[model samples]
Target: MHKPLLTTDFLDRARRHYADEEAVLAVDGTRYTYAELGERADRFSAALQARGIEKGDRVAVLDPNTHYHLEAAYGAMQVGAVHTPLNYRLTPDDFSYMLSDAGVDAIYADAEYAANVEAIRDEVPTETFLTNDADAVEGDWESFDAALDDADPDAYERPEMDEDEVITINYTSGTTGDPKGVCRTHRAETLHAYLISIHQEITDDDVYLWTLPMFHVNGWGHIYAITGAGARHVCTRGVDVAETFDRIRGEDISYFCAAPTVLNMLGDHHAEHGGATTGDNDVRVATAGAAPPEATIRTVEEEFGWELKHVYGATETGPLITTSDAKRHFDEGADDRFAVKKTQGIGYLGTEVRVVDEDGEDVAADGETIGEIVVRGNQVMDRYWNKPEATEEAFSERLEGYYHMGDLAVVDEDGFVSIQDRKKDIIISGGENISSIELEDTLFEHDVVSDVAVIPAPDERWGETPKAFVVPESGDPDDAGATPEELKAFVRDRVADYKTPGEVEFVAELPTTATGKIQKYELREREWDEEDRMVGEG
Candidate 1:
C-alpha cells in the first residue's frame, strides 16, 4: 500500500513514538516534550482556523531559530495551509513584497522582528497578525501563547493533503532581482528530508544545534528531518561563537549545519581560546553556501576533532542535492581527504548532478573544463510561484527537465563535482577565464587574511580584472600586516600570473547574507557602477 508522504507526517511520527521524550530545548531554557510540542502545534492550528485561515492559504512566519518557528510552521502545515517562512534579517520593504506577493492570510512574527512587519502592515493582504510577546510589540498583534491558550487543541480538523500539493513557498535571496517564491510539493519536501537524513546521518539519539536559520530553505530541511528522526532540537535565536561552544559542551550537540563563514568564525574563536571550545561529544558539522578552503576544513576536522561535510545546492533545488561526505572515496584522517571534502562531491542518492557545456553535453571529467551544473532530482522545487517565465527559464536553460544551477563547476576523473565560480561571477580578463572562487581561496590561505571576497573590476586595458576585498586578521585595514604588493606577489607565485588580483582593498569585514554567505554581488556592483556594461557582453 502506498501512503501519501505529507510534511505533517514528521510531526505525527514524533508525537506517536517520541511523545514523552525531549523534543526541543528552547533558547530561553524551556524544555518541551514531543507530546507538548505536538499539542501546541494543534492549538496553533485551531487558532489559525478560528482566524479564518483555510487550506492552501499562505501563513507567513518571521522569526529567528526559536521554538515558535517550528510550532508556527507545523501548525500552518497541519491544517494544509502553505507554510511560508521569512528571513528575520530582511527589511520592511522585503517583507511587504513577499507578503503581498504570496497573498498571506496570517503571519506570526517574533517579538524582536514584529516591528518590521508592523511598519508595512498597510501594504500587505494579511489581516491576522500574531507575535510571541504581544506586550512587547507596538501594534494590534495578538499574543501567540494567548491564542494557543484560548483555543482547543482538538477543535481543528486537518484537511486531506496529496503528496503533489504545494505545502511550502520558500522565497529566494533575490540577489539579482525581486525575490521569487519557490513552490515545493509535499513529495519534494518529504523526499528531501529523507535524503538529508540518510546523507547527514541523523539519528534519534542525536542532539541538533540550530546555527542555521529556519528561514533558509526550511533550515536546509532539517526541521522535518531531525524531527522525524526523533532527535532533540537545541534552538537558539542566533549563532554566537561562544554560545555555540557552550551549547556543544553543555547539551552534547551531535550535529549542526552552518555556512563556511561561521566555521571560520568558530575556528578563529577556537584559536584565541585554545581547547575550551571543544565539547565532550563528537560533532558533525555540515557546511555549505560556499566551499570551505582546505585550511578551514583542516582546522575544523584536525584541530576541532569534528567531521566536516561540505554539501552544495541552491534554494531552488532543496538546497542539499550534493554532499562531500562520501566515505568510499577517501580514508578518514588522511590529508588527502580534505581535498576530496573540498569539492562539492557526488550527488545524493537518486539525485542526478551533471556539469554540462553550452550544448547541454557533459563536460570531460578532466577537472579543468568549466561547465554549468544541472540537476534532476525528486527534491528539487516544482516551480516559481506565479512566475511561469522564470520557472521555464530555470529548468529549460541548459538542459530540458533538469534545473540549471547557474554555478560553473568541473568533474574529476572519479566523478566528484567541484564548483569553480558562479556563472556571472567568473572574471574574464584579456580573453582568459579566471574563477573568483579560486582567487578567494588562495587569498584565504594567507596568514593575515581572515575573510576575503573576489570580484571582477572594470579595467580599461583588460576589460575586466580581478579585485580582492580582504578582511584582515587585525580587523583593521591600516594595520593589515601585509602590503597589497606583497599579497599580489603571493598569489602570483602560487597561481598563473594573469590570475593575480590587480587591486587589493582591506576592509573591517566582508558583507554577508543572513546565512553567513558573503555577498559578492554587492562588491561586483560597486566595481561596475561606473561602467556602462559588465565584461563579456556586447
Candidate 2:
C-alpha cells in the first residue's frame, strides 16, 4: 500500500512519536510540547471550521518568525484549507491586492501587522480576522489563543486530500509586476521537505533558530522538515545580531537558515564586539538569496567555526532545489573547497538543474558560457494562482516543462552552477556584458565597504555604465574611510576595466526586502527614471 504523501503526515508523525517532547520554544520563552502544539493546531482547525472556513478556502497568515505561524499553517493544512502566507513587511496596498486576489476567506495577522490588513479590510473578501494579540490591534480581530481555548479540539474533520491537490500558495515579491501566487501541491511540498531534511541534515536533537522569515516558502520548507524530524524550533521576532548570538549559545542552536545579508550583519558584529559566536553545539548555517562573496563564506567558516551550506532556488521552485553541501567535492585544498562551496553545488537527489541557451539546448559546461538556469523536479510549483497567462509564460519561457529561474548563470564541468546576475541586473556597457554580481563581489573585498549594489546608470557615451552604491562600514556616508576615486581604482586593479564602476556613491544603508535580499530594481529605477527606455531593452 502507498501513502498519499500529504503535508499533514509530518505533524501527525511528530504527534505520534514525539508527542511528549519539546516541540517549539516561542519567541517569548514559552515552551510547548509536541502534544500541546498538536492540540493547539487541532483547536485552530476547529475554530476555523466553526467560523465557516471550508476545505479549499484560502487562509492567509501574516506574522514574523513565531510559533503562531507554524500553528496557523499546520491548522489550515490539517483541515485541507490552503495555507497562504503573507510577507509581513508588505504595505497595506500590497496586502490588499494579495488578499483580494486569493479571495482569502479568513486571515491570522500578527497584532503588529494586522493594522495593514485592517486598513484594507473593506476591500477584501475576507470575513474572519484573527490576531495573536487582539488587545494591541485596532480592529475587531479575535485573539488566536481565545479562539483555540473556545474551540472543541475534536469538532473539526480532516477532508480526504490527494497528493496533487494544491495545498499552499506562495506569492512572489512582485518586483516587476503584481505579485503572482505560486501554487504548490501536497506532494510538491512533502517532497521538498524531504529533500531539505536530507540535504540540511536535520535530526531529532537539532535546534533550528528561526532567523529566516517563516513566510518565505514556509521557511524554505523547514516548518515541515524540522517538525517531521521531531526537532526543536527556537522562534524569534526577527534577526537581531546580538539576540541571535545569545540564542545560539543559550539554546545550543545546531542549524538555521539566513540570507547572505544577515550573515554579513553577524560578521560585522563579531568584528566590532568580540565574543563567542557559537556554544557547545556545532553550528550549520544555510545561506541563499544571493551568492555570498567568498570573503563572507570564509569568515563564516573560519571565524565563526560554523559549516556554511549555500543553497539556490526561487519561490516558484521548492525554494531549495540545490545545495553546496557536497562533501565529496571538498577533498581538494582549502581554496578549492571555498571555490566549490561558492558555487551553487549539484542539485538535490531528484532535482534536475541545467543551464540552457535561448533555444532550450544545454549550454557548454566550460564555466564561462552564460545561460539561463532552468529546473524540473517534484517540488516545483504547479502553476500561478488565477493567472493562467503568467503561468504559461513562466513555464514556457526558454524551455517547455522546466521552470525558468530568471537568473543567468554558468555551469562547471562538475555540474556546479554559479549565478552571475539577474537577467535585468546585467550591465551592458559599450556592447560588453558586465555582471553586477561580479562587480559587487570585487567591491566586498575592500575594507571600508560594508555592503554594495551595482546598477546600470545611463551614460551618453556608453548607453549605460556600471554605478555602485556602497554602504560604508562606519554607518555614516559622510565619514566613509575611502573616497570614490580610491574605490574606483581599487576595483580597476581587481577586475577588467570595463567591469569597474564608472561612478561610486556612499550610502548609509541599502534597501533590502523582508527576507534580506537587496532590492536592486529600486536602484535601477532611480538610475533610469529620466531615460525613455533602459539600455539593451526592446
lDDT of each: 0.88, 0.88
Q: Write the per-residue lDDT of candidate 2 for residues 367-398, one digit (tens) a residue.
A: 99989999999999999999999888888899
Question: For model 1, what is the C-alpha lDDT against the true structure?
Answer: 0.88
**Error in Å for residue 178 of model 1:** 0.8
Residues 331-438, candidate 1: write the lDDT tens digits.
998888988898889999999999999989999999999899999999999999999999998999978999998888889998999876566566655434466777
For model 2, what is the alpha-carbon lDDT of residue 410?
A: 90
Q: Residue 520 CA error for candidate 1 (Å)? A: 11
